[model samples]
Target chain A: MAETRQTELAHADSRESVTPLGPVRRSRDLRVYLVVLGGVMMLADLSFIFWVAPTDSILGDIQRVFYFHVPIAVMSFLAFFVVFVASIVYLVTRSPAWDRLAQASAEVGVVFVTLALITGVIWARPIWGVWWTWEPRLTTTLILWLIYVAYLMVRAYAANPNQGARYSAVVGIVGFVDVPIVYYSVIWWRSIHPSPVVGPLAQANALEGTMAAVLLFSFITFLILFVFLVAQRMALRETEDRLGGIKSAMRRRAESVF
Target chain B: MVLVWKDILLEVRSRELVISVLVFGLLVAVVFNFALDVTPQRVTAIAPGILWVAFAFAATMAMSRAFVREREQGGLEGLLLSPVSRDAIFLGKALTNLLFMLLVEMVLLPVFAVLFGFSAMSFTLIGTIVLATLGFSLVGTLFSAIAAQTRSREIMLPVLFFPVILPVIIGAVEASTRAIGGETTVGLGRWLPLLAVFDALFLVICPWVFSFVVEE
Candidate 1:
């Protein structure tokens, strides 16, 4: 009974250290509201896509993927930007909260990027007649995917959590710096030798009223979804970190007892 | 300056760093020579690509040694303990990596010229190699330092290095193509500047990050 109570106190202490200082009760309510808002918004956004928004005259129904695809791409970039900023903060502050935030954002960013790539390929097959191309946007997105995947790998392979946080923070910054250059290099390459096959008319033709509205709405909806996912990931990461701490602390105590 | 000299002097004595990199670079060239089956007709067109692939991979090996050797010898902590700033240490290691890569290039360029029938003496091509190598060295040094502290480092270095350093590769290959094909310097202008820009950008960025990787 004494040991069990001690373990419980230890657990509570670790949890308090890891827990964010906001109204803890309100956060649960906030999470619940976020899910409900996100679900309803996502459903409305889908309806706006399939039924309300007019299809492209040139590309037709397959172009509907644009609504979700573009926003996810934007969110992935947003996620990574959070990572970049959070990483800088983590380095400066050495705070586990910021590290968890950076890690969570990176993971969500990677997943969003994967979704964007899949939707891109799905759209590309019928429109571009290939599963993939070296289009500037797509190419840079691919590079973005690789860099963060490497970031995740570093985190996984690290010798310890503190080391993982430090190394990945470095990678997070470097990877962001690389993304724009990758885009520029691809753009320059394409400019030098114009690809023979003409690309989709999406860039050349601007979206009209309803199409624009739907795209904007979906982007907002996805942003909410992205924030929700990241918050959940961060909470889980904090719990895992707290548990690791308690385990090690218990181990040290056990060693002392012997 | 002393850091560079220390590394170079050590490299000259053991001769292992440059020699191993040279062998690996030569092997990449030779293997690609077979792999691409570079017929005379196809050689010039593909020459830039092959040369760069060799250079990049070879430099990766050199970069891997930059810190890994120091680490294994237990000299890294001593270097860290020295009074020099972290940036200086990074610059010294990067400069050493740059020189090692250039040495390999000086040897490999002639071989590439012979095999692919391009004149190695083209100033434009030589300029591209120098500029591109600058970018590669800066980024590679920092990554090598980062990877040195990790597991499966050889693999980690490339995974982290390649995607980031790709612009240099593209710019180098494009510029080299124009140079080796005997094209005018006008064609060389864009790609070289792109490389210079990348070098300048990362020159500031890499050393800053190196501080983080080595921070105790």
Candidate 2:
């Protein structure tokens, strides 16, 4: 209990230090709301995946990865879209909040993209008979991953924090623009990846009614997860900003004492 | 306009940028001869890819040096402090870089043809080169400025650049391959628009963001 109290004091102290830059007025209730909503959606998605969605006619149990895989892929794209919008806003307004949002979404997007790629590889193993192929979708996602990875690296290596934010905002905007080009370039060439299931060209009734419901549940769950993860990451960014402020303050104080 | 002319005149007087890029590009093509072990007959099939790889690398080399002259001469800050807008500086530098790259490419093309024996001098091939080079220089110049401020400026430029420009390279190679293979009009028809679109997007976006980058 004493240890817990000490930890709480440290947290409060850090939070206080962040106010010099204007406290990140993050809504605790909003975070709690997202976490609760995500938990509920996750439970519903798992239930549907196990109990409602039928086994694939061709691929059987292994094909179940699709229910989680496709939704996460969609969420990853959404996350990058957020990064693009946030980057633009940051550039226009020069607001640290938007930069924080952009950076947070990009980091979360990488995680989602990684999960999608792993699930994609697993799904490909039994079906495509290979662990990986340069399919159009796979290749585009890989490039997207690389661009954002470079974005993060630029931010990490920049000479100054402010300059890094400016540089990364530029990268974030440019990198997002490449996504559609990567997609179109690959699509124009050739693709071994499966065609869309819900588009105009999709097969009639490719998804059964129950399967559609489960997939929808998965998408909702993943969207909630995306929101929760981004908020959590944004909060961590605030804490970091606060700690940096506190460290510089302490250094200034030490110099004066000397 | 004045900035652009200044850059051009500076290059004209020194002749360093064009000469180095041209020699380096030609050397790369020659090296590809021994590296790939291409038989004369197979040159038509592989020449486009080799040419693009060489151009891409050569363009990167020239771009890494884009701001080094200004930085070395201690003129970057004076330019930034001048009444000219940041966009003008970017434009001036980009135009000069574009001219230098095209000069290198124009000379490299004949040399490449002589070396590879691949007849890569058609109208369609020229069109593809122009479009590809425009996009290359625009993106390269912007990244060159960004990388110049970093510790590992030379290395950072390529690492930050090549992946972003992969689509341009693919489009150029595919189009140039078809053009060299005698499908000139059809190949140009297919890929030229894609390259044009990429160039147009960067032409507008890079300058807008460049001011932000150079400011702080």
Count clashes in each candidate, considering only residues at least 3 apart in sequence or on different chains. Answer: 0, 0
Q: Across residues B1-216, which tens digit of lDDT does each residue of candidate 2 receive?
A: 887788888888998878888888888877888888888878877899889998999899988887987888878998998999888899888888788888888888988888888776588889889899888888889888888886677777887788789889888988888888884445456578999999999999999989888985
Query: What TM-score, to 2 decimal places, does chain A of model 2 have?
Result: 0.86
Q: What is the TM-score of chain B in candidate 1?
A: 0.96
**Which ranges of candidate 1 are over 4 A from the true structure?**
A1-8, A11-16, A20-26, A200-204
List clashing residue pairs in candidate 1.
none
Per-residue CA lDDT of model 1 for A1-258, tens digit only, reads: 899868765665665445644644566678788899999999999999999999788889998998988999999999999999999999999988899899999999999999999999998898888899888888899999999999999988887889899999999998998888889889889888787656655443688989988999999999999989988887778778766766676666668779
Which one wins on lDDT?
Answer: 1
Residue B48 in model 2: lDDT: 90
Maximum-TM-score candidate: 1
* Ten-residue stretch with the least lDDT total in model 2 chain A: A195-204
TM-score of 1: 0.95
- lDDT by residue (tens digit), candidate 1, B1-216: 999999989989999878888788788888888898988887778889999999999989889988998889988899899999999999999999999899989998998788678888988888999999999999999988888889999899999999999999999999988887775555477888889999999999888888989877
lDDT score, candidate 1, position A249: 69
